[model samples]
Every structure is written in structure tokens, then in C-alpha cells.
Target: MFGGTDDAVIGFSGTGGQSLRQQFVANYAAKTPYLGLLGLSRSPTTISLPDGYSRSFSSTLAGAWYQGAQGYPASLTFGGYDALRGNTDSVLTLPLGAEITRDIVVQITAIGISSVGDPATPVQNVAAFIDSVVPEMWLPQEVCKVFKDAFDLEWNDDLGLYLVSDSQHEELLSQNATVSLSLESQGSTVTIDLPYEAFYQPITYPLADILDGTVLHYFPLRIAANDTQYMLGSVFLQEAYLAVDYHRREFYLSQAQFPGNENEYRIVTVHPPGWSHGLSTGAIVGIAVGAFALVVIACGLLWWFKYRPRSKKRASRLSAKSTEQDRDVFGYYGREKDGGEETYEKRELDTAEPGMRGSIASRCELPSPPLPQYSPGSPERDWPKDRGSIDMVEMGDYLTARRVPVQSPVELSADSEHERRPPPVEIA
Candidate 1:
């Protein structure tokens, strides 16, 4: 089937398998908050304008932002199409306009249609809290979709080759064209071709390079649509070179070339019309996995960065701990420690001069150390004269010594020959 007519059957797909989100869900994979959007690109960095931009649902995207124009500021200029159903690159960098990307959060202060009220004239600071909503995907709006028969779906713009379900009611459509839908059902192929493409270019700066988070803005639509009249997008707009600037309320666009070796990302594109992602499942999956991996890897690297310093600091503590102590109380010699060390009393010798009273007699020669005396016949009898330390009287010249010569005074005398032990004497 080619173009559809008013007679073409128009009904919602109520069949169980007909649910729109069914095949797109990842039943076997780990679930993510925005996994559905991952069908566009692997993650945030790879995501570009319009479509790709929307897929980034990271924390950096928090607060308000804006992307593709479902609702837009009235200040922008809408650029018409180059041709019907063809590619037209919006000159974003030339400052002629801004090509919107996804992942942009717009504070949607208003949503109105071309035929009616303007929402941007709120007369105050436009606020956010979802002032309006992007219409849901499922709706029987005035969209150019395939139909089974001529119903409300039939349009004068439709190419006339495709017939509706019933032959009774013929529908009007454009001539010499073909309309098509990949929708395969009822053993019939239906399609339509349209000669219409349009783009909007608003004067913008290069601020829209990245997008994410809640978007807040005042906007009026070029055409108003019901809750069901939402646009379907592919990943191209997101993965393409793009920018968004809500501070200035402007969008920037450009052709993002793939980085040869550097980490710079590549732009996404679409080969056919009405493709939300790429034509093949492989393309869709590749984009999704790539983006997802990039985010996960980035997050992992950040954690490693933060935790790495902590570990290094702890390791350095081991070196510092050793120096903090004078020595291990038990020692660290790798062998059994010997017996307790002999304790010595700290005796402070009076290096200070003792004055005249402290001086020893010149004849005493600092009092020659008395020798030990003993009877040779017995070992115990040989009394040892332990060394005596001197304690002097504060005002007296004589030093006090507690000592007894091991030998008798007679031993000092030349006549006394008996090996004798003298009683210990305390010389004061």
C-alpha cells in the first residue's frame, strides 16, 4: 500500500503484542532508570542533539534544562524544510540558528499552539514544575501514519496509491507519490510519502554543548497538539554535534565529527525518515551499550580517584608509625629477648666546684682507693672492698666515705705479717 485515504481504517492497536513499548523493553538485562532512552546511545557523552541528547539521564543533568523543541520560546525563528522528506543540516555554528539536542532540560513554562494563545507571555519569571508536557506517543492525532481504512486518518496530502480497508469510501491524497509504513499487519503493506520537512533556527551561542536535568522555560508551539501528538525521534539528533543554552535560552548546533583518537565523540545520523533510532537493531544496541559503558566507566573512575588517595594515605601511616615510638617496648629483633637489663641508678655527679671545703687534701691525692685484704687460706675470708662513693658535708672540707680497708691497719705497718682481715670501718 502507498498513500492512505480518508477511507483507510484508523484504529488503535489493542492487541496484546501491539503495545508500543513491548519489544523495546530489556527483559534480560539489568534495569536502569532511563534504560528505555539508552536505545539511542551508549550513555551521556556520546549522546548529541535532539535524540541523543535526551538519552543522558545523569546527575549532572539535574536541575532544569532544554533540548529538542516540543515546546519552545517564541523568540526563535522556525526555518522551513529544504525539501520534502530529506536531510537538511541546520547551520547552528553559523549562529543562524540552533539545532536542538536531547538531554536538554527546558523549564516548560508554557505550551500552546500556533492557532491560539501564547504561553510565553506569562508576564513574570517563567517557572518550572512541568508547566506543560510533551504529548504521549500513543494518540490518534493529525499525524501522517498508516491506516487500515479511510477514517479520520485519511488526508489530502497522502499519496494516492495505497487503498484503505473498504473500497466504498475513497479518500483524497496527493498524486504521483508513495506513502509507506513499516507496519506489517493483516497481510497488507501500507506506506505514504510526504514532501515536507522543516527546521527552526534561533540565534544562539555555543552554550548548548551539553544537556541534562529538569528543564524549565516559557514556550509556545508552532502547532498545538493533544496529549497523543508527540514526535518520534531517532538517535541522530542526540549523537550529532550539538549544544544547548538555557541561561541565554538559546540552542547551538554543529556537525560533530567523530574524534579519530582523542576522546571526542561522534555524531549520530539517520538514513531514512521517521526513524527514532537507526534502521537496524544492531545500530540501536551498539549505541545503547556504548553510552551505558561510558557512564559506568566514568563513574568507576571517579570512585577510584576519590578512594585511591585514601588508600595511599593509610599506607603512609605504616611508615610514620615506626618513627613515632622510641623503640618497641619488647623490641623487634626476631629472636627471644635476653634477661631483664640491669638497672642503674641515675647518680648526678656534682660537676659544679664545691668551693674550698670540697677540695680533697693535697696529700690525700684524692684518697687513693683502699685495696682489698684477705687471708689466703680461705676464699670467703678474702673480703672484697666494694667501691665507696663520697658524700661530702655541705660546709666541711672532709668528705664522708662508708668504707673499711679489706686489710688491717697493721698490714700497713711493716711489722704485721699475719694475713688479717680488718673489721669494716665507717669513716665519717
Candidate 2:
């Protein structure tokens, strides 16, 4: 069974006498927030075919979480990625971490906050893992303190969260700040900017043990005791696109784009390394040039056969008529008393149909509509207030029920001493 209602039975192989299906069937007792977890790892897996053979599942996986209230739906694609969801020009590919548990790790150089009329203020650097399963950013305590000051956040010791008060929420909305994270991997860097709306989250019962059963607004952040706990979670994925090629042991990160219209979405297949469409650049160009030449030749032949002969016949007829009228003209001129002095009448040429010119002129000279002005407190200015709630409940039950106990703060360390590897090849 998948996604609650969609069910299918297939041969799945795994170790420890437990197949993928068996694991999922056993997960009901765990009462996790997600109905199922789609495997995106590069490990070899196979699907049994009706023809008594099996085939490997795709090696590439790409996806972006739905930007709640922002009108972008979650998307997942196997073997390729949705090109329109990610900025292709800014893609940064890095080799997977040596440890399987920390596959998608990157060194976060800095986290900055930028508000209207204010310059960005960046905090210290840290190495963080990007994991969508987690619901909040687990940063060093000092970084969390910086965030608290920047956003006027208050820590709820009882709840273990940064809870926002009504006035503080309003202030943040009015300020309209953006959080930017500068990430580096394999010497390549990319900055992902998350608007205020991305962090405008709500906490509800079941997900958060709200005894009053009232929804609360909070920033998704946690203070990590050590480097192992540092994580950029699903909240960060709201504005970042991730593509992983398990086969090649590399992954890519790019700023996620949320187009206003569905028509703007596009998918681009991530072909395997050393793969080709069996055509070279020169071959493609040659084909295009040849096709254009053929079209031109066909047009020339069509004009010669269909219109040129008729044009010649019409010209001959006009010549004959002119020859026949020449004598009549001369005869008329000869009989004229004014020595055939020609008179010509000057008349203005109508460049357009009677009303077309007047309408076009009127339209061209008309004033443009005045731009709409909005006051600071107007509904238009307070757009985030009207944004839909981000369903924090979907983040998973483990967030509230199985959270790790807070440990004593440990001194933060420089991430530069970590091992570095060469950058991975670009995925097309």
C-alpha cells in the first residue's frame, strides 16, 4: 500500500528477512506522521517483472516540497528532475559524504538576515546536514541566539521551540525579512534565500503538545549541542531544490522556484554519465541547416510552378492591351485642342482603412492607467497575513514525541578542518 489508498503488490527483496513491503506494513505501529517514505537512496533495488525478470529502479531522484500558502505543489520525479522548479544556472553539485548516514552534508558558511532598508547581518559558519525528514533547523545555541535577536523570537523552554507572540508575529510580518543561507560543498557555493512566508509556520495539536488545543505560531529552530545534530530540515527545503544521483554518489542543490502558473513547470531528464542521444552537436546543426535548405528550395519551386507562370501570362495580357490602347491614346491626343497638355490631380493616399488610423492614433496617445498605491498597513502590504497556514502537522510525529533530550552546550568548532573532496561532474 502507498499513500494510504494506493495499493500494489510486487516482489521486493531486502536483507534481514524483511522486504520493503514488510517494513512498511510494520510501520503502522510506529504512528509516524508520514504514510510512507519513498526511498531515494542509491542502493541497488529491483522490481519483479511479469516476464519472470527483474529490473533496477531509477538511480536518480529529484524533488521539492510544496511551498505552503505560496501555491507550489510538492513534486517528486525518479530518474530526472523538474527543470523549472530549480534554477539551472545556479546548480551546485557535490559528492556524497563518505559516511552513508550523512549523505547530503554541506558546509554552511553563514546565515544572514536581510530586511527592508537594512543590510544583511550574517552569523558564524557551521557544517550542516540537509535532511527533509527533520522539521526544523538544529543550529548551534549561539546561532539560535542570533536568530532570536534578529526575529524577536522567545524560546519556550517547556515546549522546546522558539514560539512567537502575537505582537512579534505582526512585527515580523510588517518587517518582511528574508533569511539567506550560504552553503558550500567541494569549493562550490550557492546562496538560498527564504522569504518571510517560508518561515511563517503554525504549530497545532498532535504535532505539538498544545494543551489548550489552540494553534501557535513558532519559528522552526532548535539549539544543537554538537556538530552531529546540526541539520537544515524540511523548513529549508521550502526554498531549495535537491537532486540526487545515487548511482554516481553525487547530489545537486539549487534555489527552488515557485512559478505562479502551472504552465511554467518543466521536466528535464537527468541522463546517466557517459550517456548520449546518439547525435553530436555538429550533426544536429547539420540536420537543421539541411532541413532549412529543403524548405527554401520547396518554396522556390512552388512559386515557379503555381504563381510565376500566371504572373507572366498576366504581364503578356497587359502588354497586349497597352499595345491596342496606344493608337486610341494617340488618336485622342491628336484630336485634343490644348496640344495634349496632361493634367494630374493630387490626392492624399489613405494609409489605413477609414477608422483604423483614428483608433490607432487615439490608443497610442491615450494615458496609461495610474499605478495602484498601497499604504504601509494596507492588505496589499500585509500579504503574509493572508497567506495560508503551513501544515506543520505533516512534518512528522517524531518531532514532538521522539525528540532527543537537550544536552549541555558544547563549544562550536571550525568546519574547515573537515575532509574535502573534488566537485562532482555536472548533471545534465
Which candidate number maximizes lDDT? 2
lDDT of 2 by residue, 1-428 (tens): 23233223321122122123332222232223432335566665444357742333321222233243434555566789988888999988988888777889878877778863445445556878987767789999988887788888888888888988888788877887888888887788899998776776788765666557788888989999899999988788878998898778889999988776534557788788899979999999999999999999999999999999999999999999995576454442333335577532212332222424245432223232223324455443344522432221222211211112223335445676755543332211
Off by over 4 Å in 1: 1-90, 93-229, 232-240, 254-428
Tens digit of lDDT per residue, candidate 1, span 1-428? 13222321112122122122322222222222232221222233443466532343311111111222232111111222112111224323212123233333222122222212222121112211111122111212223231212122223233221222222222222222221112112243212121101111221222122134422221112222443233322222222223433334443433222222221222333233343643588888998999999999998898799988888898899767873442343232233434765432222332233435445423312432223313364432333445332233332434333333444344445566765655555433
The whole-model lDDT of each prediction reads 0.29, 0.67
Off by over 4 Å in 2: 1-35, 44-70, 116-125, 211-213, 279-428
Candidates in order, TM-scores: namely 0.17, 0.52
Best model number under TM-score: 2
Error of 2 at 162 (Å): 0.7
